[model samples]
Target: MPVPKDNRPLRSPNEKGRYRRAWKESHGNLLLAFAGLIFLIGLAMIWASPPGTPEIDVDLGTVDSADQVVSLPPNVILIRVATSQLNSEGPIRIAVYDSPHTFGNPEQAIIKDSLVPIDGFVVWEIKLDFLPEQFAIAAYHDLDDNGELNRALFNAPVEPYGFSNNARSLVGPPTYEQTIMQRPTESTAIEIRVY
Candidate 1:
Protein backbone atom coordinates (compact mmCIF):
# COMPACT_ATOMS: atom_id res chain seq x y z
CA MET A 1 0.00 0.00 0.00
CA PRO A 2 1.22 3.51 -0.86
CA VAL A 3 1.22 6.08 2.00
CA PRO A 4 -0.41 9.48 1.31
CA LYS A 5 1.79 12.59 1.80
CA ASP A 6 -0.37 13.90 4.75
CA ASN A 7 -0.74 10.42 6.27
CA ARG A 8 2.92 9.35 6.19
CA PRO A 9 3.82 6.89 8.99
CA LEU A 10 7.01 7.09 11.05
CA ARG A 11 9.56 4.33 10.27
CA SER A 12 10.39 4.02 13.99
CA PRO A 13 8.91 5.21 17.31
CA ASN A 14 12.14 7.18 17.91
CA GLU A 15 11.34 9.42 14.93
CA LYS A 16 7.89 10.19 16.33
CA GLY A 17 9.40 11.01 19.76
CA ARG A 18 11.99 13.33 18.20
CA TYR A 19 9.24 15.35 16.41
CA ARG A 20 7.36 15.91 19.71
CA ARG A 21 10.57 16.86 21.55
CA ALA A 22 11.49 19.48 18.96
CA TRP A 23 8.01 21.05 19.18
CA LYS A 24 8.22 21.24 23.00
CA GLU A 25 11.74 22.77 22.89
CA SER A 26 10.61 25.52 20.52
CA HIS A 27 7.63 26.34 22.79
CA GLY A 28 9.91 26.52 25.85
CA ASN A 29 12.28 28.92 24.11
CA LEU A 30 9.37 31.14 23.01
CA LEU A 31 8.01 31.33 26.59
CA LEU A 32 11.42 32.23 27.99
CA ALA A 33 11.90 35.00 25.45
CA PHE A 34 8.47 36.48 26.22
CA ALA A 35 9.20 36.51 29.98
CA GLY A 36 12.57 38.20 29.43
CA LEU A 37 10.95 40.94 27.32
CA ILE A 38 8.44 41.71 30.08
CA PHE A 39 11.18 41.91 32.70
CA LEU A 40 13.23 44.33 30.62
CA ILE A 41 10.21 46.61 30.07
CA GLY A 42 9.51 46.72 33.81
CA LEU A 43 13.15 47.63 34.54
CA ALA A 44 13.10 50.44 31.98
CA MET A 45 9.92 51.92 33.47
CA ILE A 46 11.46 52.01 36.96
CA TRP A 47 14.58 53.73 35.65
CA ALA A 48 12.53 56.41 33.89
CA SER A 49 10.56 57.42 37.01
CA PRO A 50 12.07 59.46 39.83
CA PRO A 51 12.60 57.99 43.27
CA GLY A 52 10.39 58.68 46.33
CA THR A 53 10.47 61.90 48.33
CA PRO A 54 13.64 62.71 50.25
CA GLU A 55 13.62 63.26 54.02
CA ILE A 56 13.70 66.82 55.35
CA ASP A 57 16.27 67.40 58.07
CA VAL A 58 15.30 70.01 60.72
CA ASP A 59 18.46 70.27 62.79
CA LEU A 60 19.37 73.95 63.21
CA GLY A 61 22.09 73.57 65.87
CA THR A 62 21.64 74.10 69.62
CA VAL A 63 20.71 77.28 71.47
CA ASP A 64 22.79 77.63 74.64
CA SER A 65 21.98 81.21 75.57
CA ALA A 66 18.72 82.96 76.38
CA ASP A 67 19.71 85.60 73.85
CA GLN A 68 19.88 83.04 71.11
CA VAL A 69 16.44 81.65 71.97
CA VAL A 70 15.01 85.14 72.04
CA SER A 71 16.53 85.89 68.66
CA LEU A 72 14.50 83.13 67.07
CA PRO A 73 11.61 84.46 64.96
CA PRO A 74 8.00 84.36 66.17
CA ASN A 75 7.33 81.38 63.88
CA VAL A 76 9.63 79.22 65.96
CA ILE A 77 7.95 76.49 67.95
CA LEU A 78 9.67 75.28 71.08
CA ILE A 79 8.99 71.62 71.65
CA ARG A 80 9.84 70.60 75.22
CA VAL A 81 10.01 66.82 75.50
CA ALA A 82 10.11 65.15 78.90
CA THR A 83 10.82 61.46 79.09
CA SER A 84 10.76 59.45 82.32
CA GLN A 85 13.18 56.97 80.76
CA LEU A 86 15.81 59.60 79.96
CA ASN A 87 18.66 57.23 80.76
CA SER A 88 17.87 55.17 77.66
CA GLU A 89 20.37 55.42 74.83
CA GLY A 90 19.94 57.10 71.39
CA PRO A 91 18.36 60.32 70.19
CA ILE A 92 14.74 61.43 70.44
CA ARG A 93 13.23 61.47 66.97
CA ILE A 94 10.33 63.80 66.18
CA ALA A 95 8.15 63.90 63.07
CA VAL A 96 5.69 66.69 62.29
CA TYR A 97 2.82 65.71 60.02
CA ASP A 98 0.64 68.26 58.34
CA SER A 99 -2.05 65.81 57.26
CA PRO A 100 -3.76 62.76 58.67
CA HIS A 101 -2.63 60.68 55.70
CA THR A 102 0.99 61.40 56.55
CA PHE A 103 0.56 60.81 60.27
CA GLY A 104 2.85 58.17 61.80
CA ASN A 105 4.90 58.17 58.62
CA PRO A 106 8.21 59.76 59.49
CA GLU A 107 9.36 59.84 55.89
CA GLN A 108 6.32 61.90 54.86
CA ALA A 109 6.68 64.31 57.76
CA ILE A 110 6.94 67.97 56.80
CA ILE A 111 9.60 68.51 59.43
CA LYS A 112 11.85 65.97 61.16
CA ASP A 113 14.19 66.52 64.05
CA SER A 114 16.37 64.46 66.36
CA LEU A 115 17.63 65.60 69.74
CA VAL A 116 20.03 64.16 72.31
CA PRO A 117 18.41 63.20 75.60
CA ILE A 118 18.98 65.54 78.51
CA ASP A 119 18.52 65.12 82.24
CA GLY A 120 15.67 67.64 82.55
CA PHE A 121 14.14 68.17 79.12
CA VAL A 122 15.24 67.81 75.52
CA VAL A 123 14.08 70.78 73.49
CA TRP A 124 13.66 71.11 69.73
CA GLU A 125 13.09 74.58 68.26
CA ILE A 126 11.52 74.17 64.86
CA LYS A 127 10.62 77.06 62.61
CA LEU A 128 7.21 76.34 61.10
CA ASP A 129 6.83 79.41 58.91
CA PHE A 130 6.59 77.21 55.84
CA LEU A 131 4.37 74.55 57.38
CA PRO A 132 0.61 74.40 57.40
CA GLU A 133 -1.57 76.09 60.01
CA GLN A 134 -2.39 72.80 61.69
CA PHE A 135 -0.08 69.87 62.23
CA ALA A 136 0.43 66.86 64.50
CA ILE A 137 3.55 65.52 66.07
CA ALA A 138 4.82 61.99 66.73
CA ALA A 139 7.92 61.46 68.81
CA TYR A 140 9.82 58.34 69.79
CA HIS A 141 12.81 57.63 71.98
CA ASP A 142 14.97 55.56 69.64
CA LEU A 143 16.84 53.55 72.29
CA ASP A 144 18.51 51.43 69.63
CA ASP A 145 19.43 54.32 67.29
CA ASN A 146 18.02 52.23 64.45
CA GLY A 147 15.75 55.06 63.18
CA GLU A 148 12.64 52.93 63.71
CA LEU A 149 10.06 52.43 66.42
CA ASN A 150 11.08 48.97 67.47
CA ARG A 151 8.13 46.75 68.28
CA ALA A 152 7.78 43.40 69.91
CA LEU A 153 5.13 40.72 69.47
CA PHE A 154 1.56 41.99 68.88
CA ASN A 155 3.03 45.25 67.54
CA ALA A 156 3.60 46.76 70.97
CA PRO A 157 6.34 49.33 70.97
CA VAL A 158 9.51 48.39 72.79
CA GLU A 159 10.62 52.00 73.10
CA PRO A 160 8.87 54.98 74.63
CA TYR A 161 6.80 57.18 72.29
CA GLY A 162 4.35 60.07 72.54
CA PHE A 163 2.24 62.40 70.47
CA SER A 164 1.47 66.06 70.61
CA ASN A 165 -0.90 67.09 73.47
CA ASN A 166 0.32 63.95 75.27
CA ALA A 167 -2.42 61.99 73.58
CA ARG A 168 -2.91 58.37 74.60
CA SER A 169 -4.65 55.48 72.88
CA LEU A 170 -6.12 52.38 74.42
CA VAL A 171 -5.37 50.24 71.39
CA GLY A 172 -2.87 51.64 68.88
CA PRO A 173 -1.45 55.07 68.14
CA PRO A 174 -3.52 58.24 68.61
CA THR A 175 -5.41 59.62 65.63
CA TYR A 176 -4.19 62.78 63.92
CA GLU A 177 -7.05 64.80 65.44
CA GLN A 178 -6.07 63.74 68.93
CA THR A 179 -2.56 65.10 68.46
CA ILE A 180 -3.28 68.08 66.22
CA MET A 181 -2.15 71.54 67.31
CA GLN A 182 -2.53 74.98 65.84
CA ARG A 183 0.58 76.77 64.64
CA PRO A 184 1.36 79.66 66.92
CA THR A 185 1.58 83.11 65.45
CA GLU A 186 4.25 83.95 68.01
CA SER A 187 6.97 81.97 69.69
CA THR A 188 5.20 79.39 71.82
CA ALA A 189 6.02 76.25 73.76
CA ILE A 190 4.36 72.82 73.94
CA GLU A 191 5.27 69.78 75.98
CA ILE A 192 5.19 66.05 75.26
CA ARG A 193 5.93 63.41 77.85
CA VAL A 194 6.90 59.97 76.65
CA TYR A 195 6.04 57.06 78.84
Candidate 2:
Protein backbone atom coordinates (compact mmCIF):
# COMPACT_ATOMS: atom_id res chain seq x y z
CA MET A 1 0.00 0.00 0.00
CA PRO A 2 1.10 3.61 -0.61
CA VAL A 3 2.40 5.50 2.43
CA PRO A 4 -0.15 7.59 4.37
CA LYS A 5 -0.09 11.34 3.70
CA ASP A 6 1.19 12.02 7.29
CA ASN A 7 4.04 9.46 6.66
CA ARG A 8 2.80 7.43 9.72
CA PRO A 9 2.19 3.73 9.49
CA LEU A 10 -1.47 2.95 8.88
CA ARG A 11 -3.29 1.72 11.99
CA SER A 12 -4.96 -1.70 12.15
CA PRO A 13 -8.73 -1.79 11.49
CA ASN A 14 -9.58 -2.02 15.24
CA GLU A 15 -7.19 0.82 16.08
CA LYS A 16 -8.64 2.96 13.28
CA GLY A 17 -12.17 2.44 14.60
CA ARG A 18 -11.10 3.34 18.14
CA TYR A 19 -9.25 6.43 16.92
CA ARG A 20 -12.27 7.59 14.91
CA ARG A 21 -14.48 7.21 17.98
CA ALA A 22 -12.00 9.13 20.11
CA TRP A 23 -11.75 11.93 17.54
CA LYS A 24 -15.53 12.27 17.35
CA GLU A 25 -15.83 12.41 21.14
CA SER A 26 -13.16 15.12 21.42
CA HIS A 27 -14.73 17.12 18.59
CA GLY A 28 -18.14 16.92 20.26
CA ASN A 29 -16.62 18.04 23.56
CA LEU A 30 -14.97 21.05 21.84
CA LEU A 31 -18.25 22.01 20.24
CA LEU A 32 -20.04 21.76 23.55
CA ALA A 33 -17.41 23.98 25.23
CA PHE A 34 -17.68 26.55 22.42
CA ALA A 35 -21.47 26.60 22.75
CA GLY A 36 -21.16 27.08 26.52
CA LEU A 37 -18.78 30.00 25.98
CA ILE A 38 -21.20 31.64 23.57
CA PHE A 39 -24.08 31.20 25.99
CA LEU A 40 -22.04 32.73 28.83
CA ILE A 41 -21.12 35.70 26.67
CA GLY A 42 -24.78 36.30 25.86
CA LEU A 43 -25.67 36.18 29.55
CA ALA A 44 -22.91 38.67 30.36
CA MET A 45 -24.10 41.03 27.64
CA ILE A 46 -27.65 40.87 28.95
CA TRP A 47 -26.47 41.49 32.52
CA ALA A 48 -24.43 44.51 31.41
CA SER A 49 -27.34 46.13 29.56
CA PRO A 50 -28.99 49.19 31.07
CA PRO A 51 -31.77 48.58 33.56
CA GLY A 52 -34.05 51.05 31.79
CA THR A 53 -33.97 49.16 28.53
CA PRO A 54 -37.53 48.42 27.60
CA GLU A 55 -38.62 44.83 27.30
CA ILE A 56 -40.46 43.91 24.13
CA ASP A 57 -43.46 41.61 24.31
CA VAL A 58 -44.39 39.97 21.05
CA ASP A 59 -47.86 38.58 20.48
CA LEU A 60 -48.52 36.54 17.38
CA GLY A 61 -52.26 36.60 17.78
CA THR A 62 -54.50 39.25 16.31
CA VAL A 63 -55.99 40.44 19.57
CA ASP A 64 -55.03 40.26 23.20
CA SER A 65 -57.48 38.52 25.49
CA ALA A 66 -60.21 40.85 26.63
CA ASP A 67 -59.73 39.71 30.22
CA GLN A 68 -56.16 40.92 30.38
CA VAL A 69 -56.22 43.99 32.59
CA VAL A 70 -53.73 46.84 32.24
CA SER A 71 -53.34 49.27 35.13
CA LEU A 72 -53.41 52.79 33.77
CA PRO A 73 -50.96 55.37 35.01
CA PRO A 74 -52.24 58.32 37.02
CA ASN A 75 -51.87 60.63 34.01
CA VAL A 76 -53.50 59.24 30.91
CA ILE A 77 -55.57 60.09 27.90
CA LEU A 78 -58.49 57.76 27.37
CA ILE A 79 -59.69 57.28 23.83
CA ARG A 80 -63.03 55.70 23.04
CA VAL A 81 -63.46 54.46 19.49
CA ALA A 82 -66.78 53.60 17.93
CA THR A 83 -67.02 51.53 14.80
CA SER A 84 -69.79 51.43 12.23
CA GLN A 85 -70.45 48.51 9.90
CA LEU A 86 -67.84 46.39 11.63
CA ASN A 87 -68.65 42.97 10.20
CA SER A 88 -65.62 41.00 11.21
CA GLU A 89 -63.70 40.05 14.37
CA GLY A 90 -60.27 41.56 14.90
CA PRO A 91 -58.35 44.08 16.95
CA ILE A 92 -58.78 47.81 16.54
CA ARG A 93 -55.45 49.54 16.00
CA ILE A 94 -54.73 53.10 17.13
CA ALA A 95 -51.78 55.31 16.28
CA VAL A 96 -50.96 58.51 18.15
CA TYR A 97 -48.85 61.11 16.37
CA ASP A 98 -46.99 63.89 18.17
CA SER A 99 -46.08 66.10 15.21
CA PRO A 100 -47.41 67.12 11.81
CA HIS A 101 -44.51 65.39 10.12
CA THR A 102 -45.30 62.09 11.83
CA PHE A 103 -49.02 62.27 11.20
CA GLY A 104 -50.43 59.39 9.21
CA ASN A 105 -47.04 57.69 9.30
CA PRO A 106 -47.55 54.45 11.20
CA GLU A 107 -43.82 53.77 11.50
CA GLN A 108 -43.27 57.16 13.13
CA ALA A 109 -46.23 57.08 15.49
CA ILE A 110 -45.39 58.13 19.03
CA ILE A 111 -47.65 55.44 20.45
CA LYS A 112 -49.43 52.45 18.98
CA ASP A 113 -52.09 50.31 20.64
CA SER A 114 -54.45 47.52 19.81
CA LEU A 115 -57.62 46.57 21.58
CA VAL A 116 -60.25 43.93 21.19
CA PRO A 117 -63.53 45.52 20.22
CA ILE A 118 -66.55 45.03 22.43
CA ASP A 119 -70.05 45.98 21.35
CA GLY A 120 -68.73 48.01 18.41
CA PHE A 121 -66.35 50.01 20.59
CA VAL A 122 -62.82 49.88 21.99
CA VAL A 123 -61.04 51.94 24.61
CA TRP A 124 -57.35 52.84 24.66
CA GLU A 125 -55.60 54.41 27.64
CA ILE A 126 -52.33 56.17 26.84
CA LYS A 127 -49.90 57.63 29.34
CA LEU A 128 -49.89 61.43 29.11
CA ASP A 129 -46.50 62.14 30.71
CA PHE A 130 -44.38 61.77 27.57
CA LEU A 131 -46.84 63.12 25.01
CA PRO A 132 -46.45 66.54 23.42
CA GLU A 133 -48.78 69.47 23.95
CA GLN A 134 -50.58 68.63 20.72
CA PHE A 135 -51.15 65.31 19.08
CA ALA A 136 -53.40 63.54 16.60
CA ILE A 137 -54.79 60.07 16.51
CA ALA A 138 -55.57 57.77 13.61
CA ALA A 139 -57.49 54.59 14.19
CA TYR A 140 -58.71 51.71 12.09
CA HIS A 141 -60.78 48.59 12.51
CA ASP A 142 -58.38 45.85 11.48
CA LEU A 143 -60.93 43.52 9.92
CA ASP A 144 -58.22 41.26 8.55
CA ASP A 145 -55.86 41.58 11.52
CA ASN A 146 -52.88 41.96 9.16
CA GLY A 147 -51.47 44.79 11.32
CA GLU A 148 -52.21 47.43 8.66
CA LEU A 149 -55.03 49.15 6.89
CA ASN A 150 -55.93 47.23 3.80
CA ARG A 151 -56.02 49.41 0.71
CA ALA A 152 -57.62 49.02 -2.66
CA LEU A 153 -56.49 50.35 -6.03
CA PHE A 154 -55.31 53.97 -5.94
CA ASN A 155 -54.56 53.44 -2.23
CA ALA A 156 -58.15 53.79 -1.13
CA PRO A 157 -58.68 52.29 2.30
CA VAL A 158 -60.78 49.13 2.26
CA GLU A 159 -61.28 49.12 6.02
CA PRO A 160 -63.04 51.47 8.39
CA TYR A 161 -60.80 54.26 9.67
CA GLY A 162 -61.01 57.63 11.40
CA PHE A 163 -58.91 60.48 12.73
CA SER A 164 -59.02 62.66 15.80
CA ASN A 165 -61.85 65.22 16.00
CA ASN A 166 -63.84 62.94 13.71
CA ALA A 167 -61.84 64.44 10.85
CA ARG A 168 -62.70 63.49 7.32
CA SER A 169 -61.39 64.31 3.85
CA LEU A 170 -62.90 64.06 0.39
CA VAL A 171 -59.61 63.31 -1.34
CA GLY A 172 -57.00 61.52 0.74
CA PRO A 173 -56.36 61.51 4.49
CA PRO A 174 -57.13 64.51 6.63
CA THR A 175 -54.30 66.94 7.36
CA TYR A 176 -52.64 66.89 10.75
CA GLU A 177 -53.97 70.38 11.47
CA GLN A 178 -57.53 69.19 10.97
CA THR A 179 -57.12 66.31 13.41
CA ILE A 180 -54.88 67.82 16.07
CA MET A 181 -56.07 67.92 19.69
CA GLN A 182 -54.52 69.80 22.57
CA ARG A 183 -53.37 67.87 25.58
CA PRO A 184 -55.49 68.52 28.63
CA THR A 185 -54.20 69.44 32.08
CA GLU A 186 -55.58 66.29 33.68
CA SER A 187 -56.73 62.88 32.52
CA THR A 188 -59.07 63.49 29.62
CA ALA A 189 -61.30 61.47 27.36
CA ILE A 190 -61.84 61.74 23.61
CA GLU A 191 -64.07 59.94 21.18
CA ILE A 192 -63.38 58.84 17.59
CA ARG A 193 -65.80 57.26 15.17
CA VAL A 194 -64.53 54.97 12.42
CA TYR A 195 -66.74 54.43 9.44
Q: Find the candidate with the highest lDDT and give its number.
A: 2
TM-score of each: 0.61, 0.60
Worst 10 residues of 2 by lDDT: 53-62
Off by over 4 Å in 2: 1-74
Q: What is the lDDT, from 0 to 100, of the residue 20 in candidate 2?
A: 65
Per-residue accuracy of model 1 over 1-195 as CA lDDT, tens digit each: 466689986466577688779879789778889999999778655633323533233333356666353345466788877665656768888999999999988899998988878773578877868668999989988888998999986686778788999887656788999999988888777777665
lDDT of each: 0.77, 0.78
Residue 102 in candidate 1 has what lDDT?
91
Please provide, for model 2 over 1-195, each residue's C-alpha lDDT reduced to its tens digit, 9 standing for 90 to 100: 567989988776778689669879789778889999999778655533323523333221234378554444468877888776446788889999999988888999999988878767787777787788999999999988999999886687888898999887656788999999988877767778776
Error of 2 at 170 (Å): 0.3
Global CA lDDT of candidate 1, please? 0.77
Global CA lDDT computed for model 2: 0.78
